[model samples]
Target: MSVDLETVRRVAHLARIKVGDDEAVRLQDELNAILGFVEQLNEVDVDGVAPMTAAVDASLRRRVDEVTDGGNPERVLANAPAADDGFFVVPKVVE
Candidate 1:
């Protein structure tokens, strides 16, 4: 559960980050400290604690799911350089 210098180097390479020997050593110490703290947190008892997404309770407002156009096709295609059959027409790319 502890991070070593080689592990730090591997992680840096995987993350595409360039780290020198000194920086690698420093990151190694920091990662080890973080893992140590997480290990300490695992020692706590949470037998009856409920999982929550946030501290406050709230619900999202929703609208009916229905499909309808903007009620005007000519207006929608008014600014298009080329439109046909109530749709924007683009240059064909393939034969």
Candidate 2:
């Protein structure tokens, strides 16, 4: 995945960023170096490695699923710009 100056310019344009000709050349070299590093990483043998969400060995703690009151109605409605009873009040859109 070698990147040329023209390809770098096109990428910058697609990203809606301004880049000079010199900067484009520099970015092309940088992108090619990154691709080279990724290629090198692909050569490593990890055939038996298991996919993991976290690097730590600790197991995630979870709680039993149960339904309960979300919060006290008075607390929830406290910051409402306009509230009637326990519900938020909004302008009537339809008659």
Which candidate has the top score in TM-score?
Answer: 1
What is the lDDT, from 0 to 100, of the residue 23 in candidate 1?
A: 94
Q: On residues 7-81, what C-alpha lDDT tens digit does candidate 2 reach at each position?
A: 888889999999998888888889999888888867788899977879888988987788766879999999999
* All candidates: TM-score: 0.47, 0.44
Local error of candidate 2 at 8, Å? 0.4
Instruction: Report every candidate's CA lDDT.
Output: 0.90, 0.88
* Residue-level error in angstroms, candidate 1, position 75: 26
Worst 10 residues of 2 by lDDT: 62-71
Q: Cα lDDT of model 1 overall?
A: 0.90
Residue lDDT tens for model 1, 1-95 = 99889999999999999999999999998999889888987788988998788777878768788866688999999999999999999999789
Q: How does residue 6 of candidate 1 score in lDDT?
A: 91
Name model 1 segments beyond 4 Å from true.
Answer: 13-16, 63-95
Task: Work out candidate 1's RMSD over C-alphas.
Answer: 9.8
